[model samples]
Target: MSLHEVHKSHRVGWLRAAVLGANDGIVSTASLIIGVAAAGAAKDNILLAGVAGLVAGAMSMAAGEYVSVSSQSDTERADLAIEKKSLEENIEFEIDELTQIYEERGLEPNLAKEVAKQLMAYDALGAHARDEIGISQTAGARPVQAALYSAGTFTIGAALPLVVAWAIPGDHLIKTVAASSLVFLALLGGLAARAGGASIAIGAIRVTFWGALAMALTAGVGRAFGVVA
Candidate 1:
């Protein structure tokens, strides 16, 4: 089988978080460095800035992911609680709710009622969880996992520019950082597109174009300020 048949597309859920984290890490850190370097910062000072950005960005990603996913989890819990209470108090109405849901999905009246009855009889809560509450195996809330994936991917992506800066000597650190970051961004875009089963060329071009623009703007700002300072 081809790579596409290797597994179900459900894995794309987690992969999305990792890709987003890495993309943000690369773009933000690279732009910050380019801007600062163009502003005529010393190599040592640029290194310091890059290091600081990496740490700060990773932590911020982790905290943000955790908080956002936690909110989703809270809402999901509240939904489940209400579903349980409704199932216990109004079994008939709950079945009717399920039947209506199926009918809305294009089932005939009799078929909708039969399907709802069978599904509810088999597992009442699972039916509501999947249909009404939008909680399924593919997309569920896991705050800690999301936080860790985001933090880890961000750190890895941010390290690319840092490593390039460290490898290249002297004032050319700015050029090296920008070049390496653009290359990395292209790769990231292609990889994300591959996973999402889209046009890799389009994704690469779009990501690189945006990243280049960001760097250009930052560099322009830095140069404008550098001349003044």
Candidate 2:
């Protein structure tokens, strides 16, 4: 017998949070370091800025993920509540709703009704939640899980530039950080795309373009201010 295959959609929650957190960490931290270096800041100051960005970005990502996922969880709970109440008050109507849904999905009317009856018999709430409201256990929101994943990934990505800064000479700091960050962003994009079964080239290009733009803009601002200061 062939083994059952796991689908990528199952990882949607953590994958999205991790990718966003990591991309933000790399772009923002690298931008900060490049900006400071452009401004002729001391090497020690640049490292400090990168470290600070890592800490702040991780916390921000965590809070943002928590609030956003919590709101989604609230909506899901509200929907489930409504579904539950409808089932308790008028099961027949709810069954008809499910039947129609299956009918709309190409099942014949009689077959749809039969399937709906069986599903509702087995687990009415589970059927309604899955078919009617589009909530599945795999795709359900988990606020705490999302928050921790985002924060942890952000720290990992942000630390790359900091480590590079520590290992390199001050004279080559800005270029080194910018180049290395682009590579990191590209790799991250490719990996994320691969995980999602998307085109790696497209993902890499998209991330690299944005990373380069962020660093360029920050460096320009830093240089302009450096000259002024």
Candidate 3:
């Protein structure tokens, strides 16, 4: 017989970037549309704002994710380099360190030392990196992956409200956009939660709440400015 198990841990990197990008896309673009519409802007002007926001926000997300994840990757590489040097200079010490770590995790001393020795003999740097430094290939940072996921998801998310606004350019544009955007946000939250294995209702509610707040605040500001103008 054979046994297998599925894991979600590997999805953390790209999943986080995708969710953040999509959420920001829907929220910011929706808010911009609602605000501009509330301020008595024409349909073309409102959509133009949304288009501009989508472009700027997508670029911003891509650049930001790339830079941040690249920094993490750099740090990880630096740490690995140092660990490699340490292993070369003091191989025995490295083995003992791995043994101690295994012992701390409930293995007997003799067995721990044996296991560490075999593992280090097989791949010293890899053993230390995994057990001592907690870096692994599955969870390691990838700057290009994060950047592409963020930019792609942001564009998809931002397009939802933009499409809605374009479709219904009438007196009820504000109501339609706001309502539909909330629905889109709730769906996004639910899907993201499902993908991340979290409570769907909670995720949906939290995302919707923040999105509503953002749209409301922006709308209020737009209305105030409209009144003044």
Task: Give the number of the best model, judged by TM-score.
Answer: 2
Between prediction 1 and prediction 2, the one with superior TM-score is: 2
The C-alpha TM-scores of every prediction are 0.92, 0.96, 0.95
TM accuracy, model 1: 0.92
Clashes of each: 0, 0, 0
Q: On a 0 to 100 scale, what is the lDDT of residue 91 in model 1? A: 95
lDDT of 3 by residue, 128-216 (tens): 88999999998899999999999999999999999999999569898999999999999999998999889999999999999999999
Q: What is each predicted model's overall lDDT from 0 to 1?
A: 0.87, 0.94, 0.94
Query: Which pairs, if any, clash in model 2?
Result: none
Which lDDT value does model 2 have at 166? 80
- Write one digit per residue (lDDT tens) for candidate 1, span 63-128: 999999999999998999999999999999999999999999999999999999999999999899
TM-score of 3: 0.95
User: Which sections of candidate 3 miss by over 4 Å?
Assistant: 227-229
